[model samples]
Target: MKPVADATPKVTKSEREWRDELTPAEYHVLREAGTEPAWTGEYVDTKTVGVYQCRACGAELFRSETKFDSHCGWPSFFSPLAEDRVILREDRSLGMVRTEVLCATCHSHLGHVFEGEGYPTPTDQRYCINSISLTLVSESDQG
Candidate 1:
């Protein structure tokens, strides 16, 4: 079967425009598709109730309810808030084939997703995300 085409609208920006919008670390991960050091991400062990939004575009991506401690040294989510909120594409980098997750609106790289790890989630998928690529809006602040 053919892969389904992404329906999310594309976002276009110049390199300088992206650089100006994101921080150095954010630019590296979101724009350059780089990974932060394991266990060093801001949300790696965060356990607060909140909504995680894309740092680049402020689009809601994941919720705290879907987060789990995968012990993989990154903020892990079992699923996104909505299928259209994020996009996944095949990534063949660093000598590995993996599915890369990106912000659906901004096309900024968030991280990767892996399957069949036997996690106790609705889906057996793990979304390993970069903390720098997200912004958490705590439940208390959602009012």
Candidate 2:
């Protein structure tokens, strides 16, 4: 895994242009640190095979095979496609300290990363991702 650098978010015109092309929901959650209501996101119950990519920069983030029903009212992934593709920040808001995760490529706020401690997986990292932060590419479409 590469070291996490304080990489200034790549906010090129092309990235902004891509963002502008997305719907309001996508922009709010992916760019504005907003959350979609429970079970309302397109990927919440989606069982199709695909890869989820950043909506802003098209960077591969999560694999469909790793996604599971977290029942936390959001899309959950055991791990990101690449360790360096996401950056973890310490969130000290809401009167609590939680790990906030963001996309490294474009610095889009994906959601929070928590330890799945005591449940399963030794690493026990649960990346609770917002569905709007991603754009799904079906396996068929990738060919």
Candidate 3:
């Protein structure tokens, strides 16, 4: 699928560099478009307020205020930190069609975004992201 264009400068890296930087699990998810087992993610039940960054490129992608408990196992967000912060593309993998989310800066696979699910959130969209794909910088860390 073609990536959604944004004005943010891109971050390009070699395969070996990515492999060297990320752990096996992180690489699989962020670089290989892999999904972690449901309920196995670190941010599934997290309640801390923080900014969520792309694990691959350290780009701020989602804010803690946008996160919500969707009970879908993965960490869900109603929206990204900014529309330009992520790229959404149509995914046709695994014989199912879904919107694939990627970090705009590095084009790293973050996860999928589901819409019109009747969620009480303002956007009514659930960004079902893998926790392994993100790193949270809690409020305290910003101090």
Candidate 4:
């Protein structure tokens, strides 16, 4: 695994400056650590064929083919395109034990990952991701 420094986001601005650039919701979810309502995220029911990337740095995270309807009210992917693109941190917030996933490049809060529950994949892992933390890159962008 890469060192935490390589995955931790570097703050390039003052607190006030960051607040000014990102919306309250974005800052809350990406900076202050908050979550959006499940199933209400923009990508939950989206059928657009594309790649899901980190919103902050546009790093390719997951492909549409790996997405599945886990009925968990969140965008769930069987696995990430690159294991290095995301860093898993042990999150013990809200009195619950969960593995939180963050962007390796920016350390922006993505969501939590869960295992088991008979997922289609052999790993039985479900990466429950937040739509707000991602940007869908259309196929045309690959050119």
Candidate 5:
């Protein structure tokens, strides 16, 4: 069996610190584990080539090559840039059980992931991420 992912985060900060660091919307999604409205995220329809990093802490999470349009009203990725960069936990909110994706470094909530959706992705999984929780670094801007 595959080893269980680590639950400990590399960075820790108080709620007030996070609030001061992030914008209201970003704090809602990243710290409070909230979801953005459907089709309303900045990255939902973006097709740029680059990497998406955690908004709370600049940690590379997903690559542009892994992104795909799932029409699920959020940015979707087949997989994370690296497994260790993300942490998955069982979320049982809103009367549903789902896997919650978080930044491993900061433990900020990025979004939820669903599997067995029959997408053409290599992993057949969809990581529905919130645009507010991510900041894209376009290929041209990468140094």
Candidate 6:
């Protein structure tokens, strides 16, 4: 499904600006599509109720309610907040074919999504996203 949010992106920045704005780890994962070591991310077992937004551009990506423990060594979601909020592409890196998920607003790499994993999810898909690529806006903060 190629659901685009719009013809133009909502956020744009130069490489230097992105590097300056994000921390080294966040820049690597969010901007460079690097992965954090499994089971070491901050949100792996987190149960805090909140909306997860893109760390790079603060686009609402996932909600805490949809987060589930897939034991895949990363934060996993069954779906995004909305279809258009994320862009999925074929990632052929690491000698395997996988779907890469990115923030539709900024085009920043969030992580890979796998389908038919048989993880007991409603969608049968795992949105294996890097924790560093997201920021949790707790439900209390919504007010």
lDDT of every predicted structure (CA atoms): 0.90, 0.79, 0.92, 0.80, 0.91, 0.90
**The 10-residue segment with the lowest total lDDT in model 2:** 1-10
Task: Give the residue spans of candidate 2 off by over 4 A.
Answer: 1-5, 11-19
- For model 5, residues 51-112, the per-residue Cα lDDT tens digits are 99999999999999999989999999999998888888888897997898989999999999
Clashes of 5: 0
1-143, model 4: which lDDT tens digit per residue?
Answer: 22233444643456687578777887788767688898789999887788998876667889998888899998998888878778887888979878888877677788888887798885588989888888898787766
Clash pairs for candidate 2:
none
Among these predictions, the greatest lDDT belongs to: 3
TM-score of each prediction: 0.93, 0.85, 0.94, 0.86, 0.95, 0.94
Model 1 spans with C-alpha error above 4 angstroms: 1-10
Per-residue lDDT over 70-115 for candidate 6, one digit per residue giving the tens place of the 0 to 100 score: 9999999999999888998877888987888999999999998887
Ranking by lDDT: 3, 5, 1, 6, 4, 2
Error of 4 at 2 (Å): 13
Off by over 4 Å in 3: 1-9
For model 1, the run of ten residues with the poorest summed lDDT: 1-10
Score candidate 1 by lDDT: 0.90
The list of candidate 5 runs beyond 4 A from truth reads 1-6
How are the candidates ranked when ordered by TM-score, highest leading?
5, 3, 6, 1, 4, 2
> Between candidates 3 and 4, which one is better according to TM-score?
3
Itemize residue pairs with steric clashes in candidate 4. 39-73
- Tell me how far candidate 5 lies from the true structure as C-alpha RMSD in angstroms: 1.7
Score candidate 3 by lDDT.
0.92
> Model 4 — which ten-residue stretch has the worst lDDT?
1-10
Candidate 2 per-residue lDDT, tens place, 66-132, comes to 8877788888888888887888877777699788778888888898888845446545677888888
Decide which is better by lDDT, 1 or 4: 1
User: How much RMSD separates candidate 6 from the native structure?
Assistant: 1.9
